[model samples]
Target: MSLLLGVASLSACAQSPAPERANGGKGTTPATSADAPAVEAGTPDARALAAIRTINEEIKVDRIAAAPLPGFREVVVGGQVLYVSDDGRYLVQGTLYDVKDKKDLSQVGLSVVRRELLDTVPTKDRIIFAPPSPKYTVAVFTDVGCSYCRKLHQEIAEYNKQGIAVEYLAFPRMGVASEDFKKMEAVWCSQDRRKALTDAKNDRKVVAKQCKNPVRMQYEIGQRAGLTGTPMIITESGVQMPGYMPPEALRAALDKLAAEGEAGPGAAVAGGH
Candidate 1:
């Protein structure tokens, strides 16, 4: 079960042609056929959970429920999901795809987790660029020094024009100890955050200053959210669109999600940059 023991605390730096859903979750839900055996409800027995804990004490078992596969339980650890046998002797760490429905069961659960975490962040902590009456809002994990992040910022106005509000959260692809992180801190500390961010993105020197800021907290949140790179976009419904998209394309994707309703997996856009 060591496979269930790890998680990299960490985007798409390159551009992907289409929108894609990041691996995520929706909580305990049945993923089997009508003829399948009835799934065991409630939490797994102590012995099973204990067996999993023995693999990694640092692994905090958040939730355990019946999985799509028989004799296995879906365990949510950190921001990722793992499928562990009811006996806890076997563990599987990968996406559970519903080939028939064309859905990612793993992402279904993680999406709820991601949405819960993202909701805790208040507007005061974000650098927002929005029209007076926006149609859609997206929170983006970004690094001031990242090229793709800069490209996204360059099109901020167009995104707003498309009725998309952009809220920026610092991720600084390099670890928090890097110079890029410092630049982000500077941007967050400036008197006019929007201008400071635009200036930094445009390669202009921002005044080096320090203050109590959300840059580090936001970066840590990004790490927990499974962000691998800068410019990772999270929709209002918790669907993630990795990489960069032009304003018009982004508006269209958001529109699709809106039309599909909450049950639709907005993540089907594009991936693999």
Candidate 2:
């Protein structure tokens, strides 16, 4: 069960420039003398690295190989996988849709990466909530003030009835110093956090509290996992559900994932798109 939250409040950070058409044509321009070395078929190691380096100076190429599709290369940088045209003329930052299978395999690949990252973090370091009977377990980074987060909290019973367990991690939308962060810290520090969280979500005053909490660590984990907002859900198989899902719909989606028998995370949901 993924919780949904608004990211409209968070300030946007600088990102890499979006890919653009250089020649305003259907095909790429012929390589000029100033261009990097040409990429040869079945041998993309050296030239691919050079091309990626030319495009982004900060990127450290981890691996470069032929992509599943023709005329493209898969470039792995610091564990993030992105596709680039053979000549480095185009770069794709979004998922690659498989028209034949009608699936988003790019998400599957990213799930493997997310799972690996999550595995490295200690589960004990997080604030957890378990269902009496568990069929699926999802980790979520949450902020109490987010309206969608409250909506998800209200549906907790429905999710549990569907055999989906919800686990909570701190991701105070307002960084460490904000009142929201302090309130979350109070929740984590409370002797009965479940009750405190419920109260806070309901707009009750959170008593001033402090403890050796893992809230900061969890925030860092969320960032490293590529979570940019509260309620970023991570499934047991490491697939990310970035927004909220109604109980019935979420159950059906989970059922579909099981039926498909895929070994990785499921496709991106409509809300996420």
Best by TM-score: 1
- lDDT for predicted candidate 1 compared with the true structure: 0.67
TM-score of 2: 0.69
Cα error, residue 69 of model 2, in Å, equals 3.2
Give the per-residue Cα lDDT of candidate 1 at 29: 18
Question: Worst 10-residue stretch by lDDT in candidate 1?
Answer: 26-35
Which regions in candidate 1 have their CA more than 4 angstroms from the true location?
Answer: 1-11, 14-42, 45-52, 60-63, 263-273
The CA lDDT at 54 in model 2 is 70
Pairs in clash, predicted candidate 2? none
lDDT of each: 0.67, 0.61
Q: Relative to the unseen true structure, what is the Cα RMSD of model 2?
A: 11.2
- Mind giving the per-residue lDDT tens digits that candidate 2 earns over 1-273? 111122331222211122121232222222211123244545554556666777666543434556666887776443345787866667665557778877665555455546655665566655566677677777777888877788888888888888887788877766665688789889988888888888999999879788777676666555545565556777767666636677777667667665555323443331122
TM-score each candidate: 0.78, 0.69
